[model samples]
Target: MIGLIKNEFMKLLLRKKVLISSIVLGVLCILLCLLISVAYKFTTKEAQIESQQYIIEVFEEQLEEAETEEEKNLAQANLDEAKASLEIIKNTPSEDDPNWRINVEETINILKEQLNGLPNDSGEKEEIRKNLLEYQELLNKDIRPMSEMSPKGINMLGYLIAFLGSLFTAIIVIIISSDTVSSECTPPTLKMLLTRPVKRGKVLASKFITAFATSCIVIIGIEIIASVIMGLIFGFGDPAYPMVAGTDYKITTVNAMIGKEAIAVFNSSYLSTIFSVLLKSLLLQVLYIMAATSFFLMISTLVKSSSASIAISIVLLVSINILKVIPYVKPVLPFLFMTYGNTTTVITGEIKISTLSSLPSPIFVVLIFLAWTIIPYIISHLNFTKKDILV
Candidate 1:
């Protein structure tokens, strides 16, 4: 059994499709870092000072145009605050200065307080407060200092993991595993394998396990390669920097999650422990990769053409993601495994889509994936076990 797994993995590694896709993914990571670096240059300290000056000008115009006593007073107060903020911006040493974040915290807190006083019935006010809360959480997070936010910093890893990493993992895993069984039917391969006396179930299980193991390896490898390349370019900063993980109202640090201390403290009080939260988030990502792989595998078994299997898988994924963006389709998101791809936000109970009223809990996410995971395998298994091979 171990030998079979090894052979399966070896065959996977030798596939030119896997090799080329991985290379493309790596190049994409490098290009993303370059793009981020260029963007950072544009948003530097000088640009910020210029922005503050513009805000002061806008405030002055508002004060001059005030229509009533109440409006005049508000405009005057805003003008004063903008002037003060300009002074602080002028005095700040650099873009990465810790004082910048401190200044932001003060600004966000004041805005939050002001928004809290507004009528709750106003949708615009609620949205502003929500935005302010997210900003406040970022300011309060004990992660890397502002100085380390460059493209080369460890901070980029967080962004990479959350976005690019997730994307590449899904695409590469889907592409590689999509053809696992389907491609075998095209030539002499399927008959050759079944003629060896292996049970159909075991054969299918080996393929599934092989694909899953390959997914893990590919994801981990991407992380390692990204870290090394980015570290070489930007110099690796502190590894122990805290990653803020929670909604603005309640938050915990990455340090707490690693030691599992956050879990014990927040379990009864919060939805789940930090450890459970992160673990579930990671598990969801893994499940997503597996689910994508199996979906494609099932497609392969049903379609018999690897190209058709890949095309159908891509179309399904893209279509679901498109539907996820449409407001009316939000109710179906909970049932769709594709919507759970952003596991970190899901685990934190912060659904990114504004139209969605509530996010699923960790338990619900697990149940959704469990059904998805089982159904695909059953479809592929039944087809593979019963299908006639004429070649």
Candidate 2:
């Protein structure tokens, strides 16, 4: 059995189609990374970016230009001050009017009057009260800070590409595995194997192992080039890329979602996110391919020609892909193993997570879907082994 597994493993690694598929998938991953990274560089102004620094410098000049003694005082404030000022500008009321000035003047007066009314034991309260007023004024300014989080649209797009890759991966793996047992059972191979007096069960197990082994190779080969290509194109060492080896970790900041309220930005790191996205993406693909392979094996056992396997496999693939598109059925979408190919939803932090578990921890859903895949696989194997291949 071990020898069979080893042989199957070697068989797939050497298969030209498998090798090419893996390379292409890897290149795809790298290209995606590069594209996303470049988009991020232009869109999300980083701390070290020239534009970011230039913006800060221009802001400082504007503060100096404001010439009000308070503005000059704030000019000496650190990056935090610039950041705060920028935030104020970001949040400031928009309109062309002097009433904006009135609003500021009113708030300052109220703070001043209140401070004067308070009999201070020490001058500490007055200084703090003054700084608070200054801070408030800064908030009313027009220049805002760069967003700290990556653009939601872009990241979502990246997830989509990842998801698409996952979908195709399943189809590819299934196509490769579809001929495994069914081909052997279809013609000269089947009669020859039976004549060799190999146990029917052993033969079934070998075929199953062979198919599984091939699926694994397909996954590994595709991802290897995809990830590497993404890394090279994107050029490494950015904010999303983390320093840790942690898996399923999420990174967030005070980022805007679909509303005005500033929610904490949970910008999950790239590696774990990508890994999780891919794994989860491939998960459904794995299941679908399994089903495809099993179904074909069953057909091969029952039918007499390899050509029948091709037609049956096509029908299965098309049916599943089409069913996935139905609107009402989309919500229960994750149950379909082929659904794992959707890297987008799985990659994004769109879905709520339990504080008790890690982000992208669709563990329960995956387990259930896995059960769906495995049960059919086992049943198919049993059917092939025990039921006479009447063909």
Candidate 3:
């Protein structure tokens, strides 16, 4: 088994497709770094204050146009929140400020005032409360809050891997897995291997293992290369920078002026360091890759034509994202293997308002991924073992 796996790995490494995929990933990493750098400049403290001023003006106009008492109250609430946030931004000290802790305390006080004015069960109130706690915690720890758009090396890496890396990795993995079996069927390679007294099951298992292992390597290699390049350009940032993870989405009824309304609230449950969050995201991504590879490999085995296999896999991948937006698909969305492809969102508990009710627990998602990996492999193994080879 080990020898067969080694041989498969050798064959994979010799393919030009693997080299092209690696180059594509490396180029994307560079492009993302440039994009983040530009974004950071546009999101400076001064820029934020200017933007907030414009927002305040917009809200003031809305308040003037309010025709009903409820409209007036809603506009007032929004205006107040926006004003308070502007105050917080203004009061925020520069990095070199010695009395930054005092500024944070003042920000916390402002958030508390905003919290008190909001309705007791309002979603905005809950969000304000969460910010209050985070601010208070920062004060207690004597740590300065990092800007969301900070382009520190480690920060960019985390952002890239969480948001962009997983999707691209999946694309490459799908391309590779879709061709794994069908590509060989067109040539005499598969036929020649079958005549070597090896069980068809062992041969299929070797292929699966090789494809999975290669995908894992690709993921880790891209990250490592990205980190090195980013670190050289931007300093390897603070690993101890605070991060929030393990968020949970819950639908709650909030007291509104006219009637009770339901809102989706995402609560942060776990707090850790940036490094820790990145590690957790990568681990989840590996599991996602396993499920993806197995599922696509099954398609490759089922279709004897490589083009057909790749085309079908690409369509299925695109359909998953499209189906997720259809309201009727919500009931089964959580169970679908592709729904959890964004490991960053899954780990951070960031769900769209439309799909809040469909949030699946981390354990449940793991189970679904496992089911995908095992079941698809089983079906593929059965077919590969029994089917006649035309090669």
Q: State which candidate has the highest TM-score.
A: 3
Better of 2 and 3 by TM-score: 3
Can you write out model 1's per-residue Cα lDDT over 23-136, one digit (the tens) per residue?
887787777777777777766677777888888888889888889999989988988998888776655434365566666666677677777777654434644554454445
Per TM-score, what order, best first?
3, 1, 2
Highest lDDT scorer: 3
Compared with the true structure, the alpha-carbon lDDT of candidate 2 equals: 0.50
**C-alpha lDDT values of all predictions:** 0.66, 0.50, 0.76
| Clash pairs (backbone) in predicted model 3 | none
> Once model 2 is optimally superposed onto the true structure by TM-score, how far is the C-alpha of residue 44 displaced, in angstroms?
4.8
Worst 10 residues of 3 by lDDT: 257-266
Candidate 3 stretches with Cα past 4 Å from truth are: 46-88, 93-99, 116-120, 252-268, 352-354, 388-391
RMSD of 1: 8.6
TM-score per candidate, chains pooled: 0.73, 0.52, 0.82
For candidate 1, which ten residues in a row score worst on lDDT? 260-269
Q: Give me the overall lDDT of model 3.
A: 0.76
Candidate 1 is scored at a TM of 0.73
